[model samples]
Target: MEKPAELQAANYDLVARDTKSVGAYVKSGAPYVWVTAAAISVAFIITVALLLLTAARGLPHFWPADLVQATYKEPGKEQQHLLAEIRSSEEVTTARLLNAGLPVDEKQPLYDRLLLKIANRDLGGVDFRYVLSDWLVERSQPKDATVLERMEWGNFHGFVVALKEGDKVVASGEEAWKGYQERQDRVNDLRGKVRDIEKGKIGAVNYDLERLRLQQRRLELDGKTPERNAADFAAIEAKRKSENEKYEVLRTELDQLNAEMGRDALVMKTVDGQEVTLPLSKLIQGYRPNDMGLFPKIGFFLGAIWHFVSEEPREANTEGGIFPAIFGTVMMVMIMSVIVTPFGILAALYLREYAKQGPLTQAIRIAVNNLAGVPSIVFGMFGLGFFVYFVGANIDKALYQEGLPSPTFGTPGILWASLTLALLTLPVVIVATEEGLARIPRSIREASLALGATKAETLWKVVLPMASPAMMTGLILAIARAAGEVAPLMLVGVVKLAPSLPLDGNVPFVHFERKFMHLGFHIYDVGFQSPNVEAARPLVYATAFLLVLVILLLNLSAIRIRNKLRERYKALEH
Candidate 1:
């Protein structure tokens, strides 16, 4: 008994040493590890949050319904009605409004009023019918028409002038008066020319009429024969027709002169009166929907944060919201995960559990690894060739031949994009799953078999559950990568704006055959294809941040699930 006790000393000593070592490591390193992890996580979260908030703030100026409205109450009288809901209590002067955040030039006084500042520019001058909220009207006071003479919104200057109807002379400034006088001279000359043409035509017609009358009277008074009288009448009629033709030509010329004068008159009247100086195009640009002011900006920012953090459902058809893209991305990733997961797991199981470690297995593993390293763009090309062209064409022919030239399935669509992404990510799933399967202890399998459990039972109950967490991790990574992918989607199924979403209410709903808008594609379209580059820049940044948030959310969820699984399996390790 003493010898047995002594023999056991080595085992007891080894167990005690292991416990002390582990305890020492935990005591020395645990706090630092946790602190570093917390700091990194906080920093990352804060950075993302701030970026999203900034984007929201920048986007709120696109819509201005709450700010102010321009209404033409009468033909010549235009009124700006301010919306009460959107305005702050602080009274803003017209000059302050115009130069709120812009530079002012000394030459332009009208730029001080935001409304006038915008109205002075071409883009802002376009007639807009709007209903302003009450708050905006209350906070904004009428700007003195005289004050506009000195205020400059930007490089341009403003002026006020009184105009005589149809006169080209600006009545306020000396230069304007000179321009007006010049225009008036031109207009007077045009009118004189038109009057002269009209008088000449009238004289010619009168003379022709008199000559015809005289000829008729002479034929009757001289007692001419019927033939002579008829000839005289015909001559008179011909003369009258000729005079009428000449009068018509003169009238036409007069009309042309009048039209030219009218255009000049309009130019003189519109430009010479109370002229507001600004770059014509920039001032007249219409407000967009996103310009909902600070409150909406904050709301949108919070909504975005919630969307990225929580699993709440979103509205399906709101514009400028990330809901549709998020839905499409999740739907596509889920479909891909479902498609690739089984295949990847089965392949891994066969290679690690059933197949012998021979050259064939090694070669297969090498190929899988190589596939993982292949350029994603190459996969996109292959997908376009095989899935979009070959398989899709056949499907189109078989199911949708009635819509023949349209090529429903033969075209790039969400289904094909998902399948292509599935293929591209399959190698990742396979490699991860295989590594997880390989990490399993051989003794677990042996013990299960010795306990009368079949190979399938052991794999399904023990191996699969143990390996599930890792498989999910791989799927998450694949999804994140796929969701952010733009190049492949561009060639396969993306569009600038899809008239209908992929999932909508229709017969046999869920139209995978149609193109869809994606967040990544949206950023691309806004950045490169939009007509308004300056306006689209902020939107691009906002969209990019949203896409990043989506990927992070997916990864975080996957990690959470992995942690839960780890905790559940902890007892097994003991």
Candidate 2:
């Protein structure tokens, strides 16, 4: 009966329109291709838009904006003279405005409020203030207003009342401004010298002294008592005494510089008539933005940007540049790439060139591909358990027993962080390298075999050189992934504030056992954990921008290497 029905349908010799349409769509594959392309286009557009927004928000933080002088009259209080920078403005519902005790008109649906950076932190007790739009009776960028970037108390916004040398007023009016600028430069120079003497020379001596202590401990351990290593102890003692003398000289000079710097102070008057006397040593910079010429403004912008890039972070990392974070991130990523490449390439070679074509080999390949999909946090946990607690702790016990109470390698550090990242990105490298090797024709191997080349030699010379572009591809992917990873790094090595960089003049020079700051972690700390949310807001955008830039630069470098290798082996690839 079924045969009869099939025969009857065949006899009709008519194609169903829906069936034909479905067949045509499957054959062409246009729908799937278009959908994928559309998705990719949308993703690209979103990434570009986000980057633009970050740049708009972050890059302007370094620009020296003119200070605004506004008289804001509160309902119950008298007129408050506000000398601050109008950082930003946003519209909020009238309901929210009223909730904040502002007299918002009930008829108005929304009120525009200004974000003012009231930088007299010592007096105002806050770096930022939000003022009602309606309360502003006067708003002007006063010509004489000055903004002082400080070493402490965040920043100061006021008029230059006078320049004081101790109890006497050395300069006032126009002369005071000029004198303050000149004196500020001298103080900055003195601070630089102090920093050098303390962190460079004195720091090196301290490091050496610690090493000597370790040496003494090691000597004691080698024997049983101090008397057994008496000569070694005497030599170490002499070295320590010499180092201490050098340190004392630096300390005396530092004291002299500090005394000289503290002699001059700036007498600044706020718009409210409250005067703040800041020592020239505490002031990083002073600028009258409202009166700056175009060239001067450009100079100030450039200087500010440079300072952000070169200077150490301060004020809970909500202010100042992220130099240490930048350095650490780049160093960690570079180290990870170095460690992963050889290991990944070797594992890929063993599987591709020598392994038997069996179920086990196939299973291994599957496992590697699956590893790429594993959650990164899982890798972080694995790293903590295996690399740090197991391997690093053992290393510390074996080599640094003298530094025991404070675990050196046992603690989270740059080396462990890099290694953990290497493990996380290994699957990517293995998969890329395997694919590269698979693409190499069997005839190429045969040709090498025909030439009487050993299998190892042939693989190294022919397979590896040809596969280098793919290796670079894998490395680029690894860097892109690792550079932006805050979770794993936070677990492994990253910190909010690294007192010293991993690289310093300490013993072994590259102190990979030190905890370091990272750009991604810095962004996280500022955006979420910072106490001053308003002050930290712009910096969060800025740090995110920098992180993206670092990733882009790393990718570009790898791409450049890949392109070069591809060109060199183009004929072989063909």
Candidate 3:
């Protein structure tokens, strides 16, 4: 063998030759290579932009008052049916009105003219004309009223009574008036009672003292003035306690009565103002059933967009405005990145730095490459069987016996989905990081070693810093892969509509056992399960676009981080 110095010189010459050849190829900028690279980059950017645009279009709008009003218009058939029902009602005097239309006394003629005017004029396209109960018509002057005005003013009962029973009409009107008068009287009486109670409470102590003094004087006059003994004192104390209890009971009753009176007054005021009666609980039950047309569409569009960007907390679904899928996807990606990055980098380091160029390492390299080629669905199956059923079941049994049958960790959830994805991405990350590690100069590592640095120290202080750009590149690739993964997540965690959010105000805030929605699944659901096909098609496109955009964003962030790392390590490149 040649001397060690000579052997070192030969190795250096070989490295120099390889570097020169690589530099020449890079400078040449072959047409095919440049074209392919530019095409890919442009396609990726266009795809991402399209996705974002699609998601934005999917967002709901909530504006323009006219649209809202138009949506509330009843369906045509329903309107016609309501009109027919009103016309057929017995309250309407079809024959008499027809006769009056021909010719009659001035008052009868006026009634005919008014009826004709209302019948001819469209009540703002409101199909059903009110037919007032006979009572309402009798209460008003005969020739001056229109049913539309009565219905619009919350006189439905009066309108119906006027139409149906003429005798009952008079009775109902009198009863309504009487009821109103009685309620008003009761309200006034309660108000007076409350005022009196307030005054009594203020003067109560003085009144009690006077009464006690009068009793003491009576006892003295009767020559029965008791000694200041314990029994006599107890008797006086008991009397005082009884009086105090009576006063307290009276005050509580007065307060309760006052509250009831206030509520009644509110109701009466609302009725007088012609406000539609609706219970507070019913009002808060959900969105109003009537469509406000354009406004609701607009609101839905904006709401969808807000749901897209707000990192969908759990409350997104409950009150019906938020979405949690976007948040879960992001969270899964972050967790996957944490699990894959370091392990990938270390594996790559061993392969590129410490491993010998032998059959064993080469075989390992082939296996890793083949792992990446394995179908993603197969990986999902493996994960489900091994991680979810096997490992998770054991964990559930050991840690959550009390919550048995209701599994804690023994389900396919966000956690399992994330881990499954990490495994699926491991090969990609390893290959990328290995390629990066290979690009690093061997001379730099050797130089560090020569400076009396241990192998670990050299890797930590020198090799790692120089290779950081490559490591970031690997991470970016991993993020891109993880973000777009849907098939695996479907089997693992994704659901149609989870009743509760994964993160809530429960004991353990983040309930990983909970299923989650995903944009991919949303698209699928809309396309396949939506009741209205035509209406849902556009929504499918919108959801698909959003899913694509999310993946693009992750890739873009990774690119940015890689670029920053490149800048930081630029000095070391030489």
Candidate 4:
């Protein structure tokens, strides 16, 4: 074979020529690099486009749009004057409009139509109307046009005809608007007082009364006759009487506030020429949108967004805010994190550091991976059967014998829902933590051992601290998955509406036994199950955006923690 150096040079040249061939380049994954980059770019673009679309559709809903006053005349129907907001515009084929019996030009291929929010739903029996743009005449925004945000009915659009105290007219015309504002402020103050009495004092008294009842029932179940426990019974009765007196006082105050609020009325004349007498109690707010300036509209828009995130849902979950769902979602995720972290860490430690390395260990790892892929609803069913029906039933039977029929812990509630999610996300945490444990250098363990440290001490002080970042990574992933899980929450605990939150001012305040609302389920309920499809559509997008934001916040927190841990332990890795 010639000299060894010459032979190696010949082989290198042959290899270089082979690698330069198209087949070799393809086999080396050189072409795949561009393909992979293109795929990633496409995915990123799609994600950005989706977020922009969601923001476009959802963010504009809060803006106070100008009210349009127009005269609409159809081919065979009477001409009608309309006071409404143009909700949207669409282009429709001329032939389609003709088929729908709308008069349109045959020569034109397409005609524009305006979707108007005719908000006097009570009178029109519908909230929206679609009319050909060509049929609308004399379109203008009237300066005196008023829009009422009402507690009942969707909305009311009209002119402020008069303001009255009971049946007597107090003000009319321009004076009516000022008088109406004063009366509305008074009503708002009264409403605040009424809510304070009802939700604060009345709620507390109710809690006390219920607790006393439960105590008496428990004593009865303990075979302690009223005669034998006369003092205990008397104490409960005395407490009940005290709470009842408080309730009566609050109730009376609430009634007085209601009467005062109802005394004032607004006489509004609609575009249809019918005058409606609306009680001040029914009106949330009234604004002349057409008269609003840019700054005023911006303020109104911000106020609307705040209300959406702060108030509770109303009108079949279509018309109001969704604070309850947001609260419940956050609370459930927090509880699940608290429960899953320790269990996941312990299980991962056993698998990676303590368990015998064998076929059994390999099989167990395979099983944990498979568990992560199981449908989340299956975990819900398991939680229902094992946690609720079995464990919760036992707890209720043992501790809450007096409330046996009511089934406190035995029902689907926040606790069961959290447990279900914890189980669902457990596999992710185990895998992540195991990978973290595997990454720790063996020399670090040996060094600790040589320094006369026990295995447990070394693991506790050195290994776990370094692996903490991975644990946080797993938690971030878990939170992302848990916050958006609607199917399992539906089976476990989430409801259409929760009258009271799980955590409130009641005694033993954190009530895990209470069923609660969730944002994912709220989105589903409003988007697909509401009676008013058009009204609920924007809310669906809004709720979805809120849910995404919540997940992002939770993940960001976890990621920040993970980054800190990584930085703290970066030197140890060397």
TM-score of each: 0.53, 0.94, 0.54, 0.94
lDDT-based ranking = 4, 2, 1, 3
CA lDDT of 142 in candidate 4? 88
RMSD of each: 23.2, 5.9, 21.1, 3.5
TM-score of 3: 0.54
User: How do the residues 404-519 of candidate 2 rate in per-residue lDDT, one tens digit apiece?
Assistant: 77788888999999999999999999988888888899999899999999998998899899999999999999999999998888889999999899998776889988999999
- Runs of candidate 3 with Cα error greater than 4 angstroms are 1-30, 41-49, 52-304, 307-322, 505-508
Among residues 3 or more apart in sequence or in different chains, the pairs in candidate 4 whose N, CA or C atoms overlap within 3 Å are: none
After superposing candidate 4, which stretches have Cα over 4 Å from the reference?
1-36, 98-107
Comparison by lDDT, 1 against 2, better one: 2
* Winner by TM-score between candidate 4 and candidate 3: 4
| Residues forming the 10-long window of minimal summed lDDT in candidate 3 | 63-72
lDDT of each: 0.60, 0.89, 0.57, 0.91
TM-score of 4: 0.94
Count of clashes in candidate 2: 0
